[model samples]
Target: MVEFGSPVPEVVEALAAGFVSRELLDWGGVALRLTGVRAVDQPEFGSGRVRWRTATPVVMKGSGRDESGALGPRQAWLLPTEPEWPAYMQGNLRRKAETLGLDPGVELEAVNWIGPKRSFSVGNGLKPGAPVEVELSGPPETLRALWSWGLGQANSGGFGWVSA
Candidate 1:
């Protein structure tokens, strides 16, 4: 089932209200009629070790420092196999947690790609990724928010959608 979610309680409430009203969600030349509105309470993901599978690819990136010192993609997409994935995931989680006013203590323990790498055209370039099963550890609040939020970068762009 398609789901729209957020780590913030107010946003969740707003989404529920919109769904109840059968709102039309439109963005970037895409629109979906939000039907089958139901309030599903957040899953009870207790603290400690947890496993989450990405419904969408968990996206990451490497720094691109050109001769002019600009940031783009040194290497288009950062796959889970890359040596930099762990640190990037950690930092990304910290950023998300801090942004949501949650404690930034989530740790990335493991990630296993579950599907072939796929590419999608985004704006002027292509985004390469693959679905991943991730292992993580943190406090209950942080873990809940992580589940509510997602696994990696580009979550706002629909890339890191995950499930417990």
Candidate 2:
């Protein structure tokens, strides 16, 4: 993810050129791979909104700050069955879009839990990985951007990587 940040197109081109290299590119100790992507039918809800689903598990982390300007412990997990999950994910995506100077009207539609949630040790503590599919409806361009960039926190760390 960090490798694909600024100057993304060039980085992607370089990676593609070295696609058959014996050495694999690793991000924070985790090896990375490039997968083929395809566009699927955008599910439509009763409200006439089109939505897209994720093909990979999305990892999210929530945290707060203390009065002394100290960072709080990170609580990472997947909230597929929670009612507030959509709002939470939407907020993160919206913030990212805004940061990129794009005003996308994206909204989370449904979350389908695929179970087998597990936790893994990250930088300082544990982070949960829940394999669940989500449906999000929004502008085609915006959705495409999100699909390529990713969703939620720690995206550069390979979290919240989504697909359509």
| Alpha-carbon RMSD, candidate 1 | 3.6
Estimate TM-scores for all models: 0.82, 0.61
Local accuracy of candidate 2 as per-residue lDDT tens digits, 1-164: 32343213455556556654534666559886645322233222335344444444566654443445466674435455544456678788787667766656777777655556656677987766655666777766566556667665666666565543
Model number with the top TM-score: 1
Alpha carbon lDDT of each predicted model: 0.77, 0.57
Candidate 2 stretches with Cα past 4 Å from truth are: 1-11, 14-55, 63-78
Worst 10 residues of 2 by lDDT: 36-45
Report lDDT (Cα) of residue 107, candidate 2: 79
Question: Candidate 1's residue-wise lDDT over 4-119, tens digit each?
Answer: 77888799899787677866767667887766776567776665678888888877886544446577645546777766677888899888888888878878887755666877
| Top-lDDT structure, candidate number | 1
> What TM value does model 1 have?
0.82
